[model samples]
Target chain A: DVKVTQSSRYLVKRTGEKVFLECVQDMDHENMFWYRQDPGLGLRLIYFSYDVKMKEKGDIPEGYSVSREKKERFSLILESASTNQTSMYLCASSRGTGASYTFGSGTRLTVV
Target chain B: TQLLEQSPQFLSIQEGENLTVYCNSSSVFSSLQWYRQEPGEGPVLLVTVVTGGEVKKLKRLTFQFGDARKDSSLHITAAQPGDTGLYLCAGDVTGANSKLTFGKGITLSVRP
Candidate 1:
């Protein structure tokens, strides 16, 4: 079955370290998104890409950057990880406007 | 920014009971979606409603979109242990990125 795949299920990062989280989808979708979920905050979008090499900042993109080098792969980068940045990160892909999203299993990152 | 507000942040009920959760938004959305997420997993799409005053049913679950396309509701006929999860409502604004604005979500626990 078609699915979105995240590179890691769980990650531990040190404060001030640079971190990378990868996501790939096999459905050939044109849109990819990265979101960080926290308690009482729901899912806050960090970044989203509608096409290859195209990226747009979401509501909470202060500490995060994203790359969409290919049609099926989107990557989220943390320039400098902090303790407050630790949260459940999720990746998702969709066909186009008004389309349903297929999400990866998610990565729980703990920063210390 | 568009925001979806979900009511009853937490709910606990016994099996065979019925439940209804509300999602309201002041901004009119082009489409609305409902998602369910279990522990350690990403949110999965449960249903999507695009038309105003639309109602859809999936087995024991029912979803309704408001006449103005600004709100939605989800109702379960018979809650089960397997129905326990985080329920989120998302609204898609008419834009190029098609980024979705999500609600804080409701945590439902069904006990046997």
Candidate 2:
């Protein structure tokens, strides 16, 4: 089956450390997104890319950045991980604008 | 930003019982999608509704979109343990970004 794969399922990082979360999709989709899911806050979009090397900030892009160096690979970066950054990070890819998405298994990050 | 609100954030029901989850939004959307997510996994797309007052079904699950395209609902018949998961609703806002706005999600637990 086609898939959007995340490199890690669980990650633990120390405060002030730089973190990288990678996502790869084999579906040859053009839209990729990064979202952080929290208990009460829900899924907040951090960044999204419509094409390779093109990135746009979402509603909650603060403290996060993204890189889409290749069409199949998208990476989310934390300049400096903080304790408050602990949450489940999800990566999704879609065929085009407003299309259904295929999501990764998600990376649960715990920052201490 | 467009927002989708899911009611009954948490629900617990016995197997074989039926339940319905609601998602409401003030802003009209071009389309709405429903997803089911199991623990440790990302949300999986179950159905997508585009036109106003549209209805779709998949097995024991039924989905309905509002007449104004501002709300949606998911009804599950004969709830099983497998149906227990987080149900999320997302709306596709019309704009250049073409990103979706997700709700906080409803957590359903079906006791066997």
Candidate 3:
């Protein structure tokens, strides 16, 4: 079975804090994506990487950055977290071009 | 603009009841995928429907894609308590490279 592992299940941080969420997949997929899931808003893509060291901004990338130094690992970085940034963060990987994506368990971040 | 709209934001019914979830979109898609998410967990891919007017069956769940590639539906027969979860529909808008847009998701609660 393909597995996407998220670093944290839950996170609590103060406003203006820097946060990092990690994701690793065992399937060796070529495409990786990060998204934030909110009620009634669905999953909005924040960033995606097609290859190691190559990244592209998604529909919502403000205040968030990504790192993809390895093929199987992708990370979502919040430079300065705010209250609005508190949401469920999901990581997914795909084989690229017309392939279904496999998603991780998701990390729920609460900012106060 | 919201690309996908899922009807009946929340549905609670008896375990033996049958239910249907609808996903509609104005934009055409290359493929549509359905996922079931449990509380505090990431979504698990349930089925993927490609080809317009296609129908796929998995056990008690039946999925159908619209002929225009803009909508999809899932019907469950004899729902079980274990089937309770959030159902999400995602579309590959570009039809390539795996850039997906997701629906807000439908929450289903099947009581025993």
Report clashes for each candidate as comma-separated counts: 0, 0, 0
- Runs in model 3 deviating more than 4 A are B94-97
TM per model? 0.96, 0.96, 0.95
Look at candidate 3 and give me any clashing residue pairs: none
- Give the clashing pairs for model 1: none
Listed in order, the DockQ scores are 0.79, 0.84, 0.75
* Chain A TM-scores of all predicted models: 0.99, 0.98, 0.98
Better of 1 and 2 by DockQ: 2
Question: Given the true complex, what DockQ would model 1 score?
Answer: 0.79
Order of the predicted models by DockQ, top scorer first: 2, 1, 3
Q: Which lDDT tens digits does candidate 2 get at residues A1-112?
A: 9999999999999999999999999999999999999987888889999999999999789899999999999999999999999999999999987898899999999999
**Model 2 Cα displacement at A83 (Å)?**
1.0
Candidate 2 stretches greater than 4 Å from native: none
lDDT measured at residue B58 in model 2 versus the true structure, 0 to 100: 99
Number of the top candidate by DockQ?
Answer: 2
Error of 3 at A106 (Å): 1.0
